[model samples]
Target: MQPIRVLLADDHPLFRSGLKNVLQADPAFNIIGEASRGDEALLLARGCKPDLVIMDVSMPVMDGIECTRQLKEHDPSIKVLMLSTYSDDAYWQESMEAGASGYVLKRAVDTELIIAIRAVMEGERYIYPTLLGGFHKPGGKAAADELQEEVLSPREQEVLLLIALGHTQQEIAEQLAVSIKTVDSYKTRIREKLNLTKRSDMVRYALKHNIISDKTV
Candidate 1:
């Protein structure tokens, strides 16, 4: 059988190296390329034409979400499996929306990652098992019903995620290219919608709802 051509995309050199080593141990996988940023990943993907890309959700220059979207547009057949430190359901949903074939948490065991890769390679969608507590599948109706109740705007969801990730308001604003006041407004709206009274409450809510994993807090 032909080895699976794989591309690694992550900002952290050590993480990429570790992933490369892990995949190299499996003869079924071939490490075709490595990229340190989203744009680099895109360029390499076009050049190498890897069968799959294991990409970090957060990256400099362009985020993995936008990169995955562009990759799918350029070549729908190339699969993308998002790897992230966050176990946030919002990130998982956004990744799917951006055309990722699978979502796996960074903290997942090597076996789980391999399972996800194989599942995606076989043309099946995969979501980390821990993140699917109340749902039968990646985008199940239970999740949709919960989303209806929250009704957070995309920007608000972004803000809430950053907050749960322990980013200060200023950092969130900087990352989103918005002012601190705008971040605060988003926070206020999120709190009001969820009836949260404190930052800790928001963090708790994020964890309880799988908006973020416990490790993130």
Candidate 2:
């Protein structure tokens, strides 16, 4: 079987090196290339054509979210699994909107990262388990169900979710197969409909309404 060809994208040399070592320890993965910025990651992704891209969300020039958008835009088939310290609901939402297959906090290094990478490669979505459960109640599944049916079109919901996940306009556009202008339009619509002002407001809406529960996607 061919190994899972993987590209590592991050601005921090030490962290990237450590992750490389960890992944390489398992022969199923191949560290094919590395990039320190979003633009560079995009270039290398195109050149390397890896099966997966493992990236850190915070970086110079273009962050992980933007890079995921660009790389996915260039080739939607290439899976992206975000590796970041951000446990924010927005970051989780944005990663999904940006078409990331999974979001694993950097703190969950070995176990969670491995699971996320594998799940995404197999066409599944993964989010850290604790974050997944934080938006839910023990018994009342009704609110969760209602939140699921609320009237955002899948694309609109996709945008909202990514906004919740902490992605920027450029990043959302890249992930959603739309233009930046279109992303702005969606943002306007979302803000108006939700009567929200700040990005934190969106995150609160998602959590409060259970738009993103312990649900994987």
Candidate 3:
């Protein structure tokens, strides 16, 4: 059988390197290309036409969930397996809604990623379902389920996260490669949708809703 053609997208160079080494050691997989951000991943996927893309859930320019949505919209045949350090149910639910074939935490890569890859290649949705054991749990399960009421666009969530992280609008514009005006537009939409204005309110909303955890993405 032909090796499974694979592309990898992760912001951390050390982690990406480690993953490369892992896949390279196995003959069942073929390393095609690597990307450090979601947008770059899309470009590489289009060019290399990899059968599967190992995507990081968080990334600059474009988050992996948004990328996966766009990829599947562009070509439903391409497979995307989200890899993240987060074990939150909201994250996994959002990823599956965005058309990801599977979701796996970075911590579980050693034991479950290959299994996830195999499952996804065989047309199965895979999620390790790690329980959220480290959260503050302000409102418990209902807070997470409230995600069904309203949803933030992936870009809006990205901007909101940057805002919660104390990044200036100018900094966010620079990182997203858009004008400050565009960044403002995204912020306005986010604020309007969530009815959150203060940075602290945004942070609390993100936490209570499980859009973000205390851990770094």
Candidate 4:
């Protein structure tokens, strides 16, 4: 399959360079252009017509949300996945309202950016798991937090997250620096704690709770 064409838009040259490096490291992406301002991004998008854009929220001339709105108006098929330092609900809402296909936090980008990109390119709406809990208050964040402390121990959560990421028990053992039998024990406890019977069910639970969508995954 052809790599996904991308355009990087950020005000900082160093940050833009970092973005370029990350995407380049992944063979699934092809860098076509770079921009330092939202207006410049819009202009470049019109010219290159990339498959997706990794957009920074704050930019000169125009902000990412406005650029996203304009970009969607100009071509709804062009996907925009927001990359921002801001984690506020207002920004998230605004970006979504402006037609951004996904919103990813900058702090988590090194690990979560590719996951967010894969989701947006495949037509799935995504949010950085760090921000997911805030919106679904009373249930989302609270339940996940409760699970971390009360239900699943931190190491077990680590094991569960790896499982959700499609890692085998042996791989998890190597990564976690433990024996395969120990990894098996952790996995068994995680499944039993969640009352899950199948690996698929665990994956679904991990996804629904935003476990697989964050930094590690």
**lDDT by residue (tens digit), candidate 3, 1-217:** 9999999999999999999999999999999999999999988898899999999999999999999999889889999999999787788879989999888889978866775786689676665633323323468756634432234555667788898888999999999887797688667656655556788988887776677787833
Model 4 over residues 29-119: C-alpha lDDT tens digits? Answer: 9999999999999999999999999999999999999999999999999999998999998998799899998888888778668756765
Please, what is the whole-model Cα lDDT of each candidate in the order they appear?
Answer: 0.82, 0.77, 0.80, 0.81
- Worst ten in a row by lDDT for model 1: 129-138
What local lDDT does model 1 show for residue 69? 100
lDDT score for residue 170 of model 3: 100
Candidate 4 regions exceeding 4 Å error are: 136-217
Positional deviation of residue 149's Cα in model 2 after best superposition, in angstroms: 13
Show where candidate 3 strays beyond 4 Å. Answer: 131-217
TM-score of 3: 0.61
Give Cα distance to truth, residue 55, candidate 1, Å: 0.5
Residue range with the least summed lDDT across 10 consecutive positions in model 2:
144-153
Please report, as a residue range, the 10-residue window in candidate 3 with the lowest summed lDDT.
Answer: 128-137
Model 1 agreement with the true structure over 43-157: per-residue lDDT tens digits: 9999999999999999999999999999999999999999998876689889999999888889874646875786689676766655654333456765554643345545556
- Return the TM-score for each candidate structure: 0.63, 0.64, 0.61, 0.66
Residues 1-217, candidate 2, lDDT per residue (tens digit)? 8999999998989999999999999999999999999889999999989999998888899988988988888899999988888887788788888988877888777655764675577676666655544455444666544433343445556788888888889999888776787688667656644557897877777776666653522
Could you tell me how far off, in angstroms, the CA of residue 126 lies in candidate 3 after the best superposition?
0.5
**Model 1 / residue 131 / CA error / Å:** 0.8
Instruction: Please tell me which model should have the higher TM-score, number 2 or number 3.
Output: 2
